[model samples]
Target: MGKRLAIAGVTGAVGQEFLQILDQRDFAFDSIKMLASKRSAGKKVTFKGKEYTIEELTEDSFGDVDIALFSCGGSRTKEFGPAAVKAGAVVVDNSSAYRMDPEVPLVVPEINAEAMKQHKGIIANPNCSTIIAIVPVWPLHKANPVKRMVVSTYQAASGAGMAAMRELEQQARQVLNGEEVTCDALKYQLAFNCYNHDSQTAPNGYNAEEMKMVNETRKIFDCPDIGISATCVRIPTLRAHCESINLEFESPITPDEVRELLSTAPGVTVMDDPENNRHPMPTDASGKDDVFVGRIRQDESVPDNCGINIWVAGDQIRKGAALNAVQIAEKLL
Candidate 1:
């Protein structure tokens, strides 16, 4: 028999993607439960030719579940994750709530599957950009330690949620139709425009999204002294996220070496063809599983060929969020 599984917040964007990915990968589950908010209860959802009624997620929801996948929100996770663990369910949370907690392991199956072996019932999926950034970086770090990293992200509206994605689509049509564009999911209009991530700004002048990258990287690598900085921006794209990264290694490294290393790296695909103007883009990455990497070149600022620049893109909803959470659940199996 397969493990009994439950997906909290099944009505949300990431929750829906979790179901899709589970089916796509044919993850075995003897029973699956769909859970949502009170408003979404009683809704019927079909999976694998059977319909399951969505239920309100209460403390009792995880009683018989062997594994629970959470993507509802941090507040819900804080309130109910312990309940799930108490009920003997291993939780794979996709929120930031427990990621920084020393007790919880922030895992990317491809990068740190072994971390899950130490979990005390809860495991965290890293932030989407952090996941996308680390998949390609970890391999190179293993080869040549990365001393410092600077990243700038072009995140899509979907990172905020499905509502944000719908808002962007509506705003774009309104802009072209000469009607007023309304904003709800995001602070500013996200149609045909871009802005810094709307997450609260810290006293350090970095937004919450930017700091997640800095802090999570150190924790995942177990290297507190590694220097890292990030600038996260919300671009007017529907899905997928792209990042420009500059890495300063402990020693000199070449673009060719980086390409060769990433080529064989699991969950990474190289699309560097500068002469033909080919490179990884959100359009090509949307709905894809692998993080697409390209635009490899030497950063001339650092001497001794110690710096290299690369661009990476991945489906914010897949490898970044839902798919990663499911992969963690797979490890438990």
Candidate 2:
């Protein structure tokens, strides 16, 4: 029999993606519970041609749930995750609450499905940029061990949630109409411009988003010693995240060999067509399941052909958060 599933934060962006991906993948579930905050409660959502009412989330919400997919914020996850677990539900959490916990497995199913076996009750999904970067990187790492990675991300407004997406649209229209743009969802205007990620800056100068890439990449790859430097920026796109990744391998590996390796990698699609300059872009990756990889070339700065540069794009809400959590839930089944 299919498991009983509950979707927390059902009104949020990632929560909506969970419904779409589950239906797209035909995930077997006997029943589903739609949960949201008190303000979102009593709302209606349609799934698989049926409508369901959004119930207010409480500690008791998971009593009948076999698996709970949580996309609520870290605070909510911390407040409710253990309740779900104690009530006999496995939580595939998309927040950072339990990610760095030594007990919880930080999983990118494409990279480490086996790690799911180590979950005490919650399986932590890695950050969006980390997921998009490493899905394509893992295959290459298996071929030639990656010693270091320098990543620059062009993240979409969708990464900040639905309000930020609307803010981008509103700001763009306001700018074109010669009106004063108001900022609420994000810290600044995001139309026709870019800025460093809005996440708080740490004492070391890395923003929270950038640091997530550094720390989560190591945890997911199980290579704590691997060097990672990331500069994350918020672009004006609606969805999808793009990254420029410079990889230094332990030994020499050519761009052609990297392409060949990624071509067959699961959850990856090679889009390296330089002659016509058709490469991975946010527009191409939006709403897509596979992470698109392209621009495979040698990083001339590193010696002995040890460095390779590549570009990648993927739907952050899909693969990076909701879909990844669901994939871990699938492995449980």
Model 2: per-residue Cα lDDT at residue 190: 92
Write the residue-wise lDDT of candidate 2 on 143-162 in tens digits. Answer: 89999999999999999998
Error of 2 at 321 (Å): 1.2
Error of 1 at 131 (Å): 0.5
Tens-digit lDDT track of model 1 for 222-329: 888889999999999988999999999999999999999999999999999999999999999999999999999999999999999999999999999999999989
Q: Can you tell me which runs of candidate 1 are displaced by over 4 Å?
A: none
Candidate 2: list runs displaced more than 4 Å: none
What count of clashes does model 2 give? Answer: 0
True lDDT of residue 115, candidate 1? 90
| Whole-structure CA lDDT of model 2 | 0.93
Candidate RMSDs in order: 0.6, 0.7
Local distance difference test values of all predictions, in order = 0.95, 0.93
